[model samples]
Target: MSTKRRIATLIASTALLVGGTVTMGAGTAAADPNFTFKYSGTTSNGSFTVAVYNNGTYAGLAEWNADPVSGHPGDAMRAGDVLSDGWYVKAILLSPYRLATTQGHPATYLTPWKTGDLPEGQKVEMRVAISNGTTTYLSQYYTGHA
Candidate 1:
């Protein structure tokens, strides 16, 4: 083969290999959707509601199992409203491989009830409040990627 032709073929092969690697990495990242917060714990914290926010806009609230059949969890929020649900979500135990402390913690699986399709690495904040008619617990803030 001519030297120039051989060089061209090598360049083409390298490009193909690089492209294939990038595509495969993206697929792996997508498949392992990371949940930002896993809820857990038992307190007289009252009914729990969860809403997802991207930037300053309200994405939506989880319909949750309580209203899974109905498809709407009965309430929606505007840009600045405090988000809540009529009940508390179960908490999750972080993977043993993870460094998160498991002591007295409750874990809630959030993927089932979270608002919408959240792309990886988007900055998000979760606000949670527990209320029991006369008493309302303070809202807690958890910020991370989704």
Candidate 2:
């Protein structure tokens, strides 16, 4: 086939693939709450970090708010402050053998809780990694029980 015809065929094929994906609901994957738990907080422009805690102990940082509801957690932002936000997360319930003692303690995720949706018997803390350009801010952990 001619060069022009070849180009046209490739473009048409690409469009068809994309359109099929949309028709299958590829864009609505985030709307499902069954995939993760939700948290709430705020931050400034730049990259923010989230760490998990359990019973006043640090578990790790690999699984805290990794997948955000709208975007991946710690996604880049414009240069400025931001409003408090909510985060959807999934709990690491633990593997076989060891009992799941990490329940109800926010699962030691990086993202903070919402303005008024934290669970009881849990203590959440956040440290703003201050920088010359980027800044971080989070709401106080709204413990369910004082």
Candidate 3:
């Protein structure tokens, strides 16, 4: 084969190999659709409510309490905290809590969630975190809809 032709063939073969590898890796690296419930708020010493709505109708509710921690009052819920039914809570913190911080991502294998227990196409009103009483902090809401 001519030298120029040989070099062109080699380059073409390398490109094909690299392209094939990338195509295979793309499938593995594809991210799964994320369904998460997340919220954050402040409270000195009070209780907060996490509520889920479906099609403008009330569906479920979960509550957490804020108590004193390190001389600062706060509340938090961890991942795998099962709400009523199959609702699970997962929190991805943006940063470490300072004090009086309450936050988490809540989702479930139920209605109003992808891969949820409930059927799809349900209109989720809002996932809201509210702090009330004397130690009321800012109320946070999860704006994502299912």
Candidate 4:
């Protein structure tokens, strides 16, 4: 193709790509009773982050009017079980695993999730799991994107 033609083609391709990402984001996972998540996808990119909040109520973060859950036992957030209790995000989709653990209890933290090559709107399904050494609490499976 000629130089001018090539440039025009490139511009058209770019527009389509940007538009596609927005369209793909339309299917962003619905809010789960567990926690809240958000993702805006882009071509040729991967990984995303989600902030987990503990709404002090039975409904968890899903409840808008709930109070902030307090008491970060041990005063720190942890992935696996430790001396005390904390909170973490568990990917319950394909291979279940723990993502980055952020602040817990009285505070909210963001978790960085890897969704390798999230070019075509990758979907992330996970739940906020919390434990207090005695009982483990969970939010609904929050669906988000990357």
lDDT of candidate 4 over 1-146, digit per residue (tens): 86434533553465566552101112122322233333222123222222333332221121110111353221112222221224333323322233434335333433333323332344444444343332333333444433
Candidate 2: C-alpha RMSD after superposition: 20.4
Better of 1 and 2 by lDDT: 1
User: Among all windows of ten consecutive residues in candidate 3, which has the lowest summed lDDT?
Assistant: 20-29
Clashing pairs in 3: 37-105, 37-106, 55-123, 109-116, 109-117, 110-116, 110-117, 110-118, 111-118
Of the pair 3 and 4, which is ahead by lDDT?
4
Residue lDDT tens for model 2, 1-146: 96434533553465466552111111112322211112333222212333332232333331222123465432111111121122222222111101112223332233332223223322333221111112111111211111
lDDT of 3 by residue, 12-84 (tens): 4655665521111101122221122223332333334454333333433433334435543233322233233
Query: How much is the lDDT of residue 33 in candidate 2?
Result: 20
Q: Is candidate 3 or candidate 4 better by TM-score?
A: 4
- Model 4, position 92, has a per-residue lDDT of 32
Ranking by lDDT: 4, 3, 1, 2
Provide the global lDDT of candidate 2 against the true structure: 0.25
lDDT of 1 at 123: 37
* Segments in model 3 whose C-alpha atoms lie over 4 Å from true places: 1-46, 68-74, 78-93, 97-146
